[model samples]
Target: MTEQGQSMLNRTVRKRHQLSAESIAKDLQISCGLQISITAVRRELHGMGLHKRAAACKPYITKCNAKRQMQ
Candidate 1:
C-alpha cells in the first residue's frame, strides 16, 4: 500500500475497529479504486502495527425485548 493508502487504512480502522481484511480490501477497492489482495492488506496492516481481532458478538435488545426479558 502507498503512504496515502496506508493512512487511509489507518484512519478507517480507527473509525471502525471491527473490520476484517476482506472487508477492508473491498472497501479500498470501492473507495480508492485500489486493487489489492487480502494477504497484501493483512501484511500492510501488520506492518502498520495492526493485527486481526475478532469482534464481540452482542445481541441487540429492542425496547420490547428488554421489557419481555424483565418480566
Candidate 2:
C-alpha cells in the first residue's frame, strides 16, 4: 500500500474505540477514496495483526452506592 493508504488505515484504526476492520474500511473508503469493501479491510487488518477484539466494559455503579461503599 502507498503512504496515503497507510495514513488512511492509521487514521481509521485510531479513531475507533478498538481497531475495527469494518470502521477501517469505511474510513479508508471515505478518506482515501479507495472504495474498498469491508472484507478487504478485514483482510488488511488481519495481515497487520490489527483485527478487532472484544472490549470489556466496566461495571456501572450508582453514585449513591459508590458513596456508601466509600464510607
Candidate 3:
C-alpha cells in the first residue's frame, strides 16, 4: 500500500467531499508528483475498504390485517 498516495487522497477527500478518483489522481499528480490513473485510484480506494453509499430512509410495514387476509 502506498501510504503517501493514500494520505494525499484522504486529505483531498476530506477537504473536498465531492472529489472522485479522477480528481484524486489529478491532485496527486500536481501535489505529490505521482502519475496515476483513475482506475488505479479507484482500485486503491477499494483496497482501502472505502465505498460510496447513501443513507436510506424506509418506512416499516406493520399494519397489515392478518385476520382479514385469512378470511
Question: For each candidate, what is the lDDT?
Answer: 0.84, 0.71, 0.75
- On residues 1-71, what C-alpha lDDT tens digit does candidate 3 reach at each position? 37877788777777777547887888889987988888988887777666666659975544476555666
TM-score of each: 0.66, 0.53, 0.62
Candidate 3: RMSD to truth: 4.4
Which is the better candidate, 2 or 3, if ranked by TM-score? 3
Per-residue lDDT over 2-55 for candidate 1, one digit per residue giving the tens place of the 0 to 100 score: 888888888777877755899988888888788989998899889987777766
Give me the overall lDDT of model 3: 0.75
lDDT of 3 at 38: 89
Give the clash total for candidate 3: 0
| Segments of candidate 3 deviating more than 4 angstroms | 59-71
* TM-score, cand. 1 vs. native: 0.66
lDDT of 2 by residue, 1-71 (tens): 66667667766776764666666677677766888777767776677767567758987899998998999
Best by lDDT: 1
- Kindly give the stretch of ten consecutive residues in candidate 1 with the minimal lDDT sum: 10-19
Q: For candidate 2, which ten residues in a row score worst on lDDT? A: 15-24
